[model samples]
Target: MKTIVKRSSVFFLICLILLMPISSFAHGMILKLEEPGVLKVEYDGGGFSPRTEITIYDEEGNELGKGPVDEEGKFHFDPGMKVHSAIADDGMGHRAEYKEGVEEKNIPKVPVVIGVFAVIAVIFVLFNKKAKARQQ
Candidate 1:
């Protein structure tokens, strides 16, 4: 009857919602080089697409090395020479790249910490002086 149809429709909608992510996750990749000379790659989808290709390049755009990822969607490579960047491709147009080097920082940490402590000390001294004046 009408109740049976309603329950079936609800179940169908729930199934569709669960399967949507799988299709949406079909693309995307990530490349990282946490350690010097070694690069790591991962895919964004639920799991890595096997045999995904990866290429390494230097700052000058010279190819350093190239290889395929393992079944786990993870690839590790040691560029015999220094690499300035790396790129990962899932062969389906999903690609990602990372460049090596430190990002420019305007302010240094040590000076900032010292400045904060100095401000705190000045505020404490002013408060103590005010408290004493009120007592007198």
Candidate 2:
């Protein structure tokens, strides 16, 4: 009885290990903007989906440009001038998308920069403080 149980357990363990890799290959797609206008698409199973097709669309859902992903899985276009969002399809049921709404850059940055400096100053003062006993 003990030998039979041991053999069954070993077989189950081997099967589990063999099936785990299949799940890795079934991973979904991922899309990211490497920069303002450069888009990157990746398959979680692989490093990048090379030769995948990319479509750039404006806010109105009209196509602006269509192309294939390069070896680095990157596509380049002028987003600020015409494009709004993009989609990458591997033609094998793997699809990734970027759908950020475009808007004007009217916000000021000086105030935000000043606030960050203030935070750094406060942290520096706090950390540089000498112990009360040491001062005495």
Candidate 3:
């Protein structure tokens, strides 16, 4: 009986580890900003649905702009100049931060988005690992 319980516990732990990753990603939070000068950000509050706040920052880590998300989960930043970071906070209790100006290139958006996606993907992967372990 003892061995059975131990084996069952270990199995449950492994299963939780696997499923936890998908659960952590169950809620999707998206941020979008078209131009560096405009700094417009859009958010989608996963399925839970909630209000969100967005913030913009410069290379020096100074806050450039901030505001609450709109009804459709959107926020705009019109600093009229380039910035470094764009952060969002769901009023329901979730926050998301984005970093810009990492690359020293002035190329078209195709390359820029590829670079940005790579960075975001790395962040998500690391975060997912920790979140999954915690959920288990």
Candidate 4:
């Protein structure tokens, strides 16, 4: 009988834990922009009590859009013009943007693979030197 009571209490606690909001402690905020300049930002809803305000900005430091996050910690931007950057201050400022030359820089995989392998080789040599010193 005592074991059964303990198990029931544990089950109730687990259910409460599951029901709690997991996003409350998460700092993994995300921002996305769709084609023709539609932006979306999401957060864990930490700073807002009634709902937090989000602001959009341009590369020229101009305000584009402003709104609040919904109950689900989600926001949408419907800027009719092209957007270069977005800024959000949910206590910690979140910033993102679309760069002008990004499309041109995203070239084919040959250059990217060579760059990645070059970085890897430099890191490996530095670590290998440290390991050899420790062994000696």
**Which predicted model would earn the best lDDT?**
2
Residue pairs in candidate 1 whose N, alpha carbon or C atoms collide under 3 angstroms: none
Model 1 lDDT tens row, 41-98: 6654456667678888878999978888776555566646778877888778778788
Per-prediction CA RMSD (Å): 18.9, 17.6, 12.0, 15.5
Clashing residue pairs in candidate 2 (N, C-alpha, C atoms within 3 angstroms): none
Alpha-carbon runs more than 4 Å astray in model 2 = 1-25, 101-136
Worst 10 residues of 4 by lDDT: 97-106
| Candidate 4 structure quality by residue, lDDT tens digits, 1-136 | 5565556556655764686555433354445454454444554343332244667767797987877766654556664765666654455554333343353122444575577657656865665566556556
The collision pairs in model 3 are 51-91
Q: What's the TM-score of every candidate structure?
A: 0.48, 0.53, 0.47, 0.37
Candidates 3 and 4: which is better by TM-score?
Answer: 3
lDDT of 3 by residue, 105-134 (tens): 223545755675576568656655665565
Q: What C-alpha lDDT values do all the predictions have?
A: 0.66, 0.70, 0.58, 0.54
Model 4 scores a TM of 0.37
lDDT of 2 by residue, 49-133 (tens): 6768999888799998989978888888885746667889989888888777643242344575567557656754553353222
Ranking by lDDT: 2, 1, 3, 4
Off by over 4 Å in 3: 1-22, 36-50, 101-136
Model 4: pairs clashing at backbone N, Cα or C within 3 Å: none
